[model samples]
Target: MNNIVVKEDVNLPALPNTVLPAISELTAALGIPRDALASHEEIEYAWRDLPRELREIPSELRGELIARMCVAVSVGLFDGAMNYIWNAAILQLRQKIRNFSLAVVAQIQQNDFEEKHLRDLQDSRLLGLCLKLNIIDEDGFFFLDQCREVRNNFSAAHPTMGTVNDREFTTFLNRCVRYALADSSSPKGVEISAFISAIKGARFIDNQRQIWVQRLTSTHDAQRQLLVNMAHAVYCDSATAEPARLNAIDLCNGLSTAFTSSIKADLINTHCEYIAKGLEEKHTASLQFFERLGLLGLLDESEQHVIFSRAINRLWDVHNGMNNFHNEPPFAERLLELSHQGAVPETIQDSFVQTIVCCRIGNGYGVSNAAVCYYDELIKGFSPREVTDLILAAKDRTSNLGRRIAGVGSCKRNFKTVLNLIDTASVPNLVRADYDNFVR
Candidate 1:
């Protein structure tokens, strides 16, 4: 048999004037009160609303079920019309599940989801499953669940508890079409098992990584966020293989642009959990995770201070060690990157300024040539407060920079070069005298 298709331009015919009166007369002849049937005014109002609401549904979706709904509405059977539209909505949701792949559903639910399970699910459970699988979003779930309740209590599919007025029926139709039938291209849910497996397996090549990233971007925001947390957890796991760790990092990096405040908060809370538990390894890994994602600015000032202090102290140690010139570039470059991330925490500003100055002014042997550029850039970018600290360091008498600048040699001349790199405008008024004296 050939299927009949409905066109979008096909208008639904209005109920004839005689229909409501005939229904009332027929009820009276059957020894039933006319009040049992809809009033003429109610039928008129409902018939007037049908055509406008039906226009919102797409042409492809206006199939036989929609035709049946129009026919029911034409006879003033508002309950039957509601039942028809509700059935159409449920069928569309079911088709979406089928297209989303039952195998993926089974993987996500962590159980076997065969055709039988899908077929046997009640309307409430079906809506719930769609929500869990991200076939519908939170708002869709909310309004559709209310539609289900209306269908259960007032639609003709069951014995009616109460009658719905023209306004209520129109609202029901609008919601069904707006939330369920209208959105035909809802995102398919990510299969959690497969995603975790991919991350835990061999390292992803460029194309493979791009494919996964696209899948993540196309999926719903909730799933993207959950996957982000999972990737972070995988990266921090002590026993995870190197390839897996890199895979997790790549996934998180890909989705980093979409991170909401909630996602960031969850990550910070997890990081704090590791710290509270005294899990040094995981804490360190979490710090690296934030740094690699360029999200260190999200951390609090005290945390930033600790991070900068450790990095500065490490660089200072390497500068004072043997073969300092050969070892200093990487450390200097790393500190430069960290400084680029955000303002230096006020607590670390003094040490931060002193270290850069001491490094720029070489020891007796001379500065690390490879690390000089990084030092110059850092000095040029210093805040006015940091410039104040720099001048103070040269006059402190006990500090290395103070003692070196007290004498006349390459060390003193390099300090002069460091002063030249600073922007003169950034010099605070209180320290202008000291800065000018150092320059002279």
Candidate 2:
């Protein structure tokens, strides 16, 4: 037997006005009876027959699927109608899955699946997976699986094992739309994603902020989690504008305290890592934000350790400025002071020590000397063993000190005296190298 093909532009032969076409003849030859072939406009009328609440589903949500389902329903092809309804349900499930895990979406886009694995995930398994992920509750899951069974048993895509009458098909279609396809019945719930994007891209005035804050807080935690997740994504997005980033930070601050303490700590950790890699503008904005958060007591000591260490590791870059700016900011000195106020993580201790040595031995008399006052405060944070490692990295980096080597000899002498004098018991015996050649 030859395979049947459904072409996009199908033209049916028109009979004379007096001719009567049998339903069986028309179906066998044209795949649908003349009376069953409804125009797209007529199918739209059938869509209106759905209840107002079911009709309220966003057209953007599986619009094509709904249109196909409507056309199938209009034509009295009840089996095909069930198949289209099942397809619509799957569309919603796939969308929710993408929003849940971007990595899974990437895998799908890359076609990173075995053929057997792909085959095993039938429509029933798709609904079951969504159920396990809490995308749909148990009742909805079981109801959808029943709908899938209907499609499999009687739909045109499968061999004709049974049939559903027109009234039965319409009721099944309505159930699918109401329970499985629509985003929500409540209007405010539908607006949460838009609200998140709005807060990120634009700043809100005082009155506007109050209105939105009220709406956001009134929503249950389940809905608010979506807002907070989207906010974090916007905050860390590199393509987000500088002003937008500041706006996102402000918005996240408002929502931060609402989250559990553990969630807030993780949130702070993520943004701190982003700010650490950003340029001077980001550094300034993020630093002030952290200071404000610290004052509010939202930022704990562990979070402070993460933030300050990241900032310290980038101090040299800020002092020299990026490729665009020539004049270095006072960030190096400011960051050096911050390091002393808290415990630096052991992971970053090596980088911190390297930064201090390079800055102290530099030839320039400007920013380099500005770093002198904090040397005592900074070195106290390290131990004797770390200091030994710091000296070695410094000697390797400054082996051929240029014109700066002259001043560096005195700088080294002063630093060693400070280290050896303070905490004399913990300090190792100073092995003095030649000041002109060795220390330089």
Candidate 3:
């Protein structure tokens, strides 16, 4: 009998910079013999036969994506390359949409997107946004979603043991480039208005409704804004008959709900910021926009969570440094209204209470009457137990700001008022005693 042992070479220093720790950690854990990591020259030679598919992309984005893809290919980083491939498509779509809406593009260009939106978006979300805007067809969106799944399961960004060979990688790379660079057929604005007007008064009977749905499903993204515009009118137009308005709202929701969940969530999330910014600019109608959305249940839990979180944080932003607590009450009230509408989840009720308590009511500013009123409204959303925990937690904190807001000594009157708002019967005697002792 003869025995042969073969040792595999491990090229420690040749690994690509894009390789995630999870991948390297897993490789080490498995004790698998590593092949010599491909060098830049080797990778470039391998990709030499791959055609330049970025010609259709805009110049600004084309150069950046080409650079990213070249580096990824040069490093033999299949996952990063795929990631960049999908990103290139989304970038082109967003750029096209920006061109379509110059004003929005200007706002983004002026850095308003930073204040109003979360900049680092995931590929699913970016593709979903494109879908909502009619920049990509449903087939394209779903196919890209599949590509995103591949990235998530095999890319350097996550911990995955999956591997991609040259054939599979090149095939997907070309497919992504095609999908991203393909031209979308946006419906003319006139077409969208006619469709909205035709559907607004028509009874949504099976035949009529089905025709409208089919047309809506086929309508391009640029034209879909008219549907939103019409829906906004239905809610905001006081002259609209009650029954007619509700019919129009229902019709609009039916069309929107037809989209996949990711697309639907994207539409809702984007609209939320748009509406909030509108409100900031003193567009009171934006509140009605949100109320109408709430009435239709178009806002899912996650969308509502984003709305609530943003609105609450804005309270501090609007008031914190400027002493402009005027907006705090309204936002706080809006947060409560959403909670009462079952928008905020029960699991998050305690966290909301914690957020309220965690607010740094500086000693110099003290707790404003608006702050007191804000929490008075906010605490109504929580259970007696949760509210009690919040009060107790506030009292236990050792900081001057905490002690000040907790109503220690000179602030006892404020603390007593907060306690009175809750049912003291459920509160521990110690909490009641502290309030009583401070008052006496």
Candidate 4:
């Protein structure tokens, strides 16, 4: 972070004593006061602070423009020093944008972006682009915008509104160095065109998938959030090819753990839009999107009810079909995953408890051995309200479960096993007596 490098034993010249008087005499001859130029004391104060301020800038950034800035400061031309430092900072910002990929900038803007466009960009607009691309953050943008204003109005770049004193000059230089020149770890921009193409192309293999996931994880949160929205859109598009759809879901699955609150908010907003606009196909796919990401809990209660009820009905249907033992595990496992995401909604708790209890109780033949673990897990996680539903199902003689339990065989024994899965503390007061009697 050293600013100025000087060789050992090299003598540096100081300002001559007669220089100030000569300037004063010339100003008197021109009929203008000597106050137009900075006093010797003001220049001395400014020079004293130069080494300290310049040390904040990185060694690699102390290029030709910086050297010129140093020379200007030594000569007491504070306005010219401001101009040189501002130019160096601007060049660094432009290089950051260029390194971020001008082609990607074009994709995001949805227009042609070239070197000329970058070079010709007004200072204000360049900061705007840098903010949008996440090359600089919000705080950086604010401070740098202030610096740009100073350069335009007070520095040598434009006609002077006022002259800057030593403190003002140091403050401007500090901001430029802190915000743009010394910041080397800003988030890199992703190339939108390449990202979209890779997602829409053939399905990704394991290594390729890992590579893309690493890229998304490495990028700025704004771009990662934008890509998540795009992935949802792609997954929901009916026209998208099967492989592409798979790719989209895979990308989402990989990055699900890294989703920020902003990303989650964007997803919820998009899902709500689909429902409001009556985009049934997209809405259906959107549900699957949430389900695959294990984000079903983020949906409203009514939507969660629909998701659970549909899953429960599908499991029940598979349970009653021919080869029920072989067909039930997958559906049961899926239901287990959904339940893990959040509680079963109050609206669907009755059917959810009954189906799981009934399936676990089994028919006269026996239970689906493969699905027993899933049913056991679901029963073990029942809320107190759901526990009440379970006890009620056992007490209702007209119901299939009660009818089977009342019989004198394996169904009765299986019902006892179901009761064992429930914790004694979970039994509601109204059902405590019935649950104890049933266990006995």
The model with the greatest TM-score is: 4
Q: Write the per-residue lDDT of candidate 1 for residues 1-440, one digit (tens) a residue.
A: 95654436446666677877788789988999877767778778877877777776777788999989887877778899999999999999998888777887786677899889998989999999888767888898999999999999999999989998778888999999988887666677678888999999999999989989989887766667778889999999999999999999998889898888878988999999999999999988888888888888999898888789989999999999989999999999989999998999999999999898888898867999999999999999999999998888888989878887776488899998999998999999989998898889
lDDT tens string, model 4, 1-440? 85664422323256567765776787889999777877667777777777766776767777899889877877667899999999999999999888877887787788999999999999999999898877888999999999999999999999999999888998998888888887544556778778889999988999999999988887767789999899999999999998999999999999999899999999999999999999999999999999989999899999999899999999999989999999999999999999999999999999999899889999888999999999999999999999999889889998778888887478889999999998999999999999999888
Q: Could you tally the backbone clashes for each prediction? A: 0, 1, 1, 0
| Superposed Cα deviation of residue 299, candidate 3 (Å) | 34
Q: Which scores greater on lDDT, model 2 or model 4? A: 4
Order the numbered candidates by TM-score, best leading: 4, 1, 2, 3
Please give the CA lDDT of all the candidate structures: 0.87, 0.55, 0.56, 0.88
* Residue range 172-209, candidate 3, lDDT tens digits: 77667666763433322224445556545645666766
> For model 2, how does the per-residue alpha-carbon lDDT over 289-308 read when each residue is reduced to its tens digit?
55544422445565566666
How big is the positional error of residue 363 in model 1, measured in Å on the Cα after superposition? 5.2
For model 3, the local distance difference test gives: 0.56
Tell me which residue pairs clash in candidate 2. Answer: 363-404
State, as a TM-score between 0 and 1, how close model 4 is to the true structure. 0.85
Estimate the TM-score of every prediction: 0.83, 0.36, 0.34, 0.85
- Candidate 4 residues lying further than 4 Å off, grouped into runs, are 1-56, 185-187
Question: lDDT: which is higher, 1 or 2?
Answer: 1
